[model samples]
Target: MNQIRPLIPLLVTAGILIGGNGLQGTFISLRALQEGFSPSVIGLVGTGYNLGFAIGCVYITRVIRSIGHIRAFSALAAIASAASISMVLLIDPFFWFLMRLIQGICFAGLFATVESWLNARVTNATRARTLSVYRFVDLGSVTLAQYLIPTVGIDGFQLFAIISMALTLSLVPISFADRSSPEPPDAVRFNVKTLWQISPLATVGCIVVGLTNSVFRSLGPVYAQGIGMSIAAIATFMSVGIFAGVVLQYPLGHYSDKLDRRKIILVATLGSLAAGVFIAFVAGDSTLLNYAGIFFFGAFAMPLYSLCSAHANDHAKEGQHALVSAGTLFFWSIGAVIGPLFASFMLDIFGPHALFIYMAAVLALFLAYTVQRMTVREGVPAEKRTMSFRNLLRTSTFFNKLATPPSEDKPENK
Candidate 1:
């Protein structure tokens, strides 16, 4: 506990970011639905933010390095706040895309800054626990945000304004925290192709993670509405599903830590595959079943990327954690850019149900490939696997700046 005292401000900052960010695109989706935008336009509206988010993650590190953490974060936060409010007023789809792009950049920059701070605060002693705590806070806040959106009533520009205010409020904790000074400026660097060489498994894992997770994040609510769930139900359904994942990540992480990380990835992919089939077939019109099945989905689906990330780190050369992390984010962005468009197009043609069809197929293929790999290569025995997430669960104080620096440029992780 003493070791993490300096991190309180960082944790609070995360709380605000997650809580606010957790709202994700609820306001946009809601308003678009209310305005009677076509399904495809709505998908684009949501996808636009993610597009920006990926771009922001890629470059925010450099922007921060050129200035400093506080200034960079402050700029991003202020801009995001303005953009959020502007979005509420500017209802045109094209303009929304522009706003979303800027908002994405700001959101990603804020996340990058926070992640870098978290990394700087850690040493070897408490790495896993810290990561667990930080991730829990993140996912927990996501669940809360999902729940909170229904209260905003989802019909007007008001919700967008609320998000704007929330983003502005986020600046307070970070700016006024009791911490004495910000860390020194950092120059960011990471190479995607290089990381791919170091760990192809991890690189592919990152892209797969991005593809599935962003699909749900961007389109789940829209999917719910298409399936005949109401607005409030959509909020609850989405939050519950996400909360299930939130609750399960620690156990899953612990379990993965004990085995060949690839095995854990394989299992998770299989679970997602099952969930996809269930949604496509068994989960017909029964909201309760949707909620329950979504819980299981979240359980297996949510943490796959983080698992891959940690796995990659385990095999990484010294000080490559951040570099690998950035590489992972790069692949993630690639997947994010592709997943929603493809899913949305399918929704446009085969129907909304096709969304899950695509998911099921993708995950199923991944599971097959992972299984084939394990069979061909020698792997650790199943019994030898053990992960300690159980002890690390529930009781969390928290804290990575996710930009990940490389050894050559920063001497951290290049």
Candidate 2:
């Protein structure tokens, strides 16, 4: 507790920043829908965020390195706050899409700055524990942020103002902190060919996850709204799914360490597929059925990225874990960019329920691929498994530093 005490301000900042971003995400979707934006345009707006995020992942480190963390964070926070309020000024889909793109880049830089600073504060002994606390912060903040939509009501400018305030307020704690800024994180590397060569299954798993999960995150509100759910119900629906993801991550990760990680990936993907099917065909307009289906859906689908990361690290050489982590995100971002656009088209053609059908189809294909990989190659020997399972957050490359297990050959600061 004493060791973590000094970092409390940063954690508070993280919570505020993450909460604001979370609210902004759901709000944008619902607002766009209310404005009578076509499903395709909504999807494009989501894609814009993902695309900008990927770009930031590749380049934001340089900004931190050049200007240092504190200034970079302040700038990013200001930009993010501006971007949040900018949406209310112009309700045009294209304008919102552009704002979302800017929001994405700013938030990406914000996360990279915060996470890398956290990494600097902890020693190897405290890394995992600190990460666990940070993950809890993330989970709690994002889940609670959903309720803000219902409380404020998404019709007017209040939600956007609240989001802007949250982002702006995040800067206060950090500005007053006693500690000096941490060193900048290493530049993100995307060694695609090498990552695929090391673990094709892990690569494919990330892409599959990106495709299916991004849809749910970006379009699930649309699904809920389309099904005649109220604003509060939509919040509950999204929150339940996210909460379920946090609940199931540890147990799934524990089992993956004992056996082949691919098996756990397969199990998670199958669960997501089943839940998707239940939501699409069985739930209909029954709120109870929808809630139950989303709970199961999130439980299985949310942990696949960590599972895949663990599997990939099992094959990675000593210092290659960072590269593997960055590469995994690269592929995932690729899928994320494409997923919403395609899913929106599906929603346009088939209606709200088709959202799950599209997700289920993707999961089914990934499930088959996982099975085939199992047949082709034997599981990693327990003695050879260099890394254990850690919940891989898609925040930044430096975030992966906490996720990497302490191996015999300590990785040098990349």
Candidate 3:
């Protein structure tokens, strides 16, 4: 039963993550369309979500650490459910922005609880498989969102509301069913600054991942619209990229596990660099080429965060995994907040190609930073190597969790 108990919570959490947050990326666009927001303003709204998400990650961990996983998990779910409804009821951009911030915080808290729960349950033997299962749920849920949006119509916030509610409700059973785990420690105390000092490449890698990911999510549609692609073309562009990333995770991860993990970074970064060039040179001219380009981009680009996390984990203290995970999330959210606003401005100034250009530039810097790490290149200890998990889980679900900050009522490290 203990073996299966882990499976239950894991599956339930996966369902909640996919059903809830996965729908949101497309849903925001649909809602923005209905609300008539300008591209720049739409980007700002996304920025607000990132700002809120960062706060949630830092604070929400503390909440779970202090309150016990069960209670904190329930509170987060309820908050998210209510926040989703509130955003629908209060449809004005200003009000929705406010609600999105609230939702960001709540969603972050819930995500932290679930991530912590997964870590708490599994021993070393199961960590890889657990991560794989989690990834599958993550991707499966989000991919479902692309299809769901057209079915419901972009203007139908109510259906999105139903989807959000269903996701939140899924958590209730998992929250109650799992025997209460011990609270997260008070100080999984590797200083963020210290961690950055140890692995500047990894630190900057998190930022890059955040920058490219949010930029794509917030502005991908804008590019499709500007290029005069059909709606199906737009969806295909986004979906195929996501699928390519999903398929690439295991092969890449296995390779990373077997070799110098940093080499994998170099390889992925270079591949992303090539994909960016493909985007810059050809995507604007042919929709099929654009689709193929973004697909390659996803294959190389999307896994950066997981790779960053794994790299950091390679150097982490035993109890520090959650802290490091959340920290990477914090940095990622920081990037996320800035990503869209910059991309939107560039889009307005230069047109759709700026989106690809923005992505290309970010990858260039990531490659440069990784190359700059001579010490890492020369003598990274074999035992300390960080092997990133297979991209099997859509771990982006955890990004929402990062939005929560340290809750005032709880300990700091949580």
Candidate 4:
């Protein structure tokens, strides 16, 4: 506790920032539905945000490099606060889409700034513990934000006002902190060929997880409303899944370290496939069953990104962890941008259940791919695996470059 005392202010800043961001995301989904936007349009709004996030990953490094972390973080937070309020003023679907895009960019920058700042403070001995605290704060705050939805009521302007307030409040701690800002991080590089040489299964797994997770994050509220859930129930539904992910991540990661990570991936994917089927076909009308299914689904699906990343790093040379991490994030972002649009289209044509159908199909395909890859390549020998876990919780390009050491040797395509 004493070791972490110095970092408390930054952690509080993260909590505030994430809480506001979480509320804004869920609020947008519900509010857009109330405004009579079609499912397809809501999906496009999600796609727009992810597209902007991807762009931010590519470019926010320059912004930080030019202005430095403290300035860049403040600027992005202001933009995010304004973007939250703008949604209320501009009620048009197209206008909201634009706002979401800007919000995504701001969020991408905010995450980069905060995470890079945190990474800078910790030494190698404290890296794991500090990252654990950071992850707990992030997931805990997001879950808490969901419960706030019922208090704010989705239809009122008050929620937007609250979101803006949170964003504004987040800046206070950082502004007053005594620590100096970290040097700007290098830009993330995406090298597909090198990643493939390291681990093909990990590459594909990142993309597949991105597709399934983004669909749920962006459109789950719409599905909940379609199934006649109340606002409070929607909050519970979303929060439960996220909470499940947080609770399960450590256990699953520990077990994966002991076995072939691909085996872990296959089992998790299979569980995800089953959960998707249950949600789509067997959980009708019983909200408890629906919630239970989502909880289990989150358990199995949410950690796959970290699993894939860990597996890739198992094969990576000592200095190449950062490159492998960056490549995986690049693929995940690509999938995130595409998933919501596809899921939304399915929702439009076949109703809410189609969301699960799309997810189940993706998981099934990934399952098959994982099985095939298992036959092709053996897992990294236990003696050869890296034991320390690195946090890849946020989709910040800067974090990837910072986590990875500079590498002179690049793997040729297999």
Q: Estimate each model's TM-score.
A: 0.87, 0.97, 0.84, 0.94
Best by TM-score: 2
Candidate 1 lDDT by residue in tens digits, 49-84: 778877786677678667877888788888988888
> Candidate 4, residues 1-414: lDDT per residue as tens digits?
777777778888988988787777788999999999999999999998988887787778788889999999999999989988888988898898888899889988898888777767766566557667777887889999998999779877999999999999999988866467787776656687899888989899989988999888999999998999999999999998887786567777787888888888888899889999999999975789999999999998988888898899889986576678678887898899999999999999999999999999999999999999988888887677754344457557545433433232233111
The 0-to-1 C-alpha lDDT of every candidate, in the order given, reads: 0.71, 0.88, 0.68, 0.83
Clashing pairs in 4: 322-404
Candidate 1 Cα deviation (angstroms), residue 257: 2.8
RMSD of each: 4.5, 1.4, 5.3, 3.3
Q: Which ten residues in a row are the worst by lDDT in model 3? A: 400-409
Best by lDDT: 2
Worst 10 contiguous positions by lDDT, candidate 1: 390-399
Kindly list the per-residue Cα lDDT of model 2 for residues 1-414, writing each as its tens digit.
887877778889988988887777788899999999978889999998998888888888889989999999999889988988988998888888898889888888898888888877877777767877888998999999999888889898999899889998999988866567776677777899989989999999899888988888899999999999999999999999988998789899999999888888989999999999999999999998999999999999999998998899899886787789889988899899999999999999989998999999999999999999999888997678877888888878777876664553277542
Model 2 backbone overlap count: 0
Instruction: Write candidate 3's Cα lDDT for 1-414 as tens digits.
Output: 455455666567657666667567656754675577766777777787778877776677567767887778777777777777777776677776777788778767666667666655665465546555666666676676677666666665666577667756777668565575765734333257855854677788888887888888777877776787766676677677777776666677777666666778888888887888888777666898888888888888877776776676566554455566556766788888899888878877887787888888888887887877745456346555533353423233343223222231123234
Candidate with better TM-score, 1 vs 2: 2
